[model samples]
Target: MKKITFSLACLLIATIGSAQQDTYVPKKTNFFSDVMFGGGLGLNFGNEFTNISVSPTALKPITENFAVGLGAQFNYLKSKGYYESTSYGVNILTTFNPIEMVQLSAELEQLRVNNKIYYPATYVSNDFWNTALFLGAGYTNQNVTVGVRYNVLYKDSNLVYNQAWMPFIRVFF
Candidate 1:
């Protein structure tokens, strides 16, 4: 009886000691600092004017899958009954990546218009413009990405909105 009890105690002690001696390794998450440059075209249709825009942007990632960036866009338009004009803007944006190769972004923009018409028979031709908010979604591969965005502009007691389906490609170095 003594021998059996002593052997059981030793076995228990050995099992506990072996368990305590084991080492654990934790999994690691992938993080990256990403810089992206891209360009695309835009089309806008409104009661005042129909325009086409060309834009180029630069972005810097602040986290593994999130980033903040700045952008600039130039627009040109021609209309028979209206004056032609050029417009440009500066914007700040924040982007998020919820999954690999997918990204979502929001932007705040301030635009300046070189020539504009205010209302019927009132040509408020000034370098005045408005602010806008934009939301976008996109996908990226190893070295290329593309996306689309919808934007809304707020003006004097009115809300103007537009959708832009822009496809862009970016190369990372």
Candidate 2:
């Protein structure tokens, strides 16, 4: 029941985002002219821990206030001698700005998580896939947005994030 409602909502947003204006595209430009590329590179290192990630996204605007996009995620994590793992995935995204400063967004992310845990004298390895749907609202300027989003599918058993609510800062060029 809940999943059905969420799927419907996402379909509605995608339909809205695909309502093209068709007024600004030039005839000779490449397909990427109106496409926006964004995402981030992150690095976290301490004495005995390390984390690295690379995310790249591309979005195409159908109108001045609506856009749809996709992104790729790659992450590497190491906890000294405890464990080391890698996670990679892809995501779909959509954003709609009803007014100049307020933006609504929906993101569907699918990730494959690989983990290695060390025990007293043995270690275990496991691989699995995790999916998350995030609905968010944000304050936006021309190239940046700051906001918080909630994962509708979050549970205590999820190993990707410790909390269902997370803050985000997005900058696109």
Candidate 3:
């Protein structure tokens, strides 16, 4: 009985002597320094279809849950006997992160295209403009993100493309 009482007293004294302490504190970061860079690139080569596309973007995190950015797009496309086109555009981007690994994104883009049509007798050039609204979801790892987006406002005679669906990959630096 005496040994048991002594052990209990020692345990209580030790527990009171060693107190817990908070060891983790987050450091504040600068707003301008907290920026991410990413974009997408695509190239297709074949006898019937050949194209090159590139887009580069920069983003600034406004809050823990929201981010906004801007991007530029350039594309060159050619068909075997059809026409060749060069297009350029600018985009505004917005992204929301409900979780760490997933993101919801929206973009507004305005593009201008110049096309040269090849004909046996004569060649003609045309210039046009297109505007697109893209909405999609993305999966992001530490530094890479991949996603698919659809142009909700797509038209057949748009300056850029007739396809409504587009896949994208981005790397953040």
lDDT of 1 by residue, 1-173 (tens): 99999999999999999999849886664533356776558798887767898877777878888877778988888564666677788888888889989978788888787775446666656666768777778797765657777665544432123233334354444
Q: Model 3 over residues 55-151: C-alpha lDDT tens digits?
A: 9999998999798999999999999677999999999999888999998899999889899888987778999888899998889887777889999
Error of 2 at 136 (Å): 0.8
Candidate 1, superposed: residue stretches over 4 Å from native: 1-34, 41-52, 116-127, 152-173
TM-score of each: 0.55, 0.82, 0.73
Per-residue error for 153 in candidate 2, Å, reads 0.8
Name the top TM-score candidate. Answer: 2
Q: What is the lDDT of residue 163 in candidate 1?
A: 35
Give a tens-digit lDDT track for model 2, residues 125-166. Answer: 979999999999999999899999999999887678888999
Error of 1 at 99 (Å): 0.6
Backbone clashes, each candidate: 0, 0, 0
**Residue 14 in candidate 1, Cα distance off native in Å:** 37
The lDDT for every candidate, in the order shown, is 0.71, 0.91, 0.87
Best by lDDT: 2
Clashing pairs in 1: none
Candidate 3 residue 48 Cα shift, in angstroms, is 8.6
